[model samples]
Target: MNKKTFLGIAALLAVMVILSAYGHKLERGSDNVISLHKLHTLAQKGEQLTWSDFENYPFEDIGSGLYIRKYEVEGGSHLLLSGGNINLAPMSINLVKTSGERIDIRYEEIRG
Candidate 1:
């Protein structure tokens, strides 16, 4: 190829490389399972869920023995809490999508 053509090709490659790097950051998630953007979205929506954006980490289930979900978010984990009661048997939570970009979370747990 001509010298000019080679230079153009090199510049294009550089631009592609930069775009790829930025794109990777957008898709990056904790343990490569979640997307950083998604985490941010969840946070903005006040969703309490363990967020491991920078590093790939797993959400730890803090057993029912302790009502510790509140502590998780404070410790850098995204804890998404919803409408649920602790003093109940077989406590569980269900997330409902009310509309676009909206979610309703219900929390239920068994309490002695």
Candidate 2:
């Protein structure tokens, strides 16, 4: 191949590499959601759960056993619950979805 053609190919390859890296970074920075029911079940079953369990969905404990899991995705955010009263059961919580940044979950123990 001629020198000009070789240089053109090399430049194209470099652009592809840079674009690939940027795409990967964007994917990693995207937000995520977790199953609240699964979380509660795990805690009730004597399983030790941590922030790492939620995979890409990182969370922050905002006092009173409440947690906030933030995601960058838009719409269709919700929480699921199963058997037993959430307010009175171990690892019970009210998963509340609010606008922007993070989803709020209120967790408290209730005695019957």
Please state every model's RMSD to the true fold in angstroms: 14.6, 11.1
Against the reference, the lDDT scores of all candidates come to: 0.39, 0.44
Q: Whose lDDT is greatest here?
A: 2
**Cand. 1 TM to true fold:** 0.29
> Over all chains combined, what TM-score does candidate 2 have?
0.30
Clashing residue pair totals per candidate (backbone < 3 A) = 16, 0
Highest TM-score: give the candidate number: 2
Q: lDDT per residue, candidate 2, 1-112, as tens digits? A: 9999999999999999999977875785644455444444543533233344445554343334444333222233443232133233324223434432222233332111
lDDT of 1 by residue, 1-112 (tens): 9999999999999999999977775664334333334444543433233322213433345656543232122223343332234343222222212222222222232111
Root mean square deviation (Cα) for candidate 2:
11.1
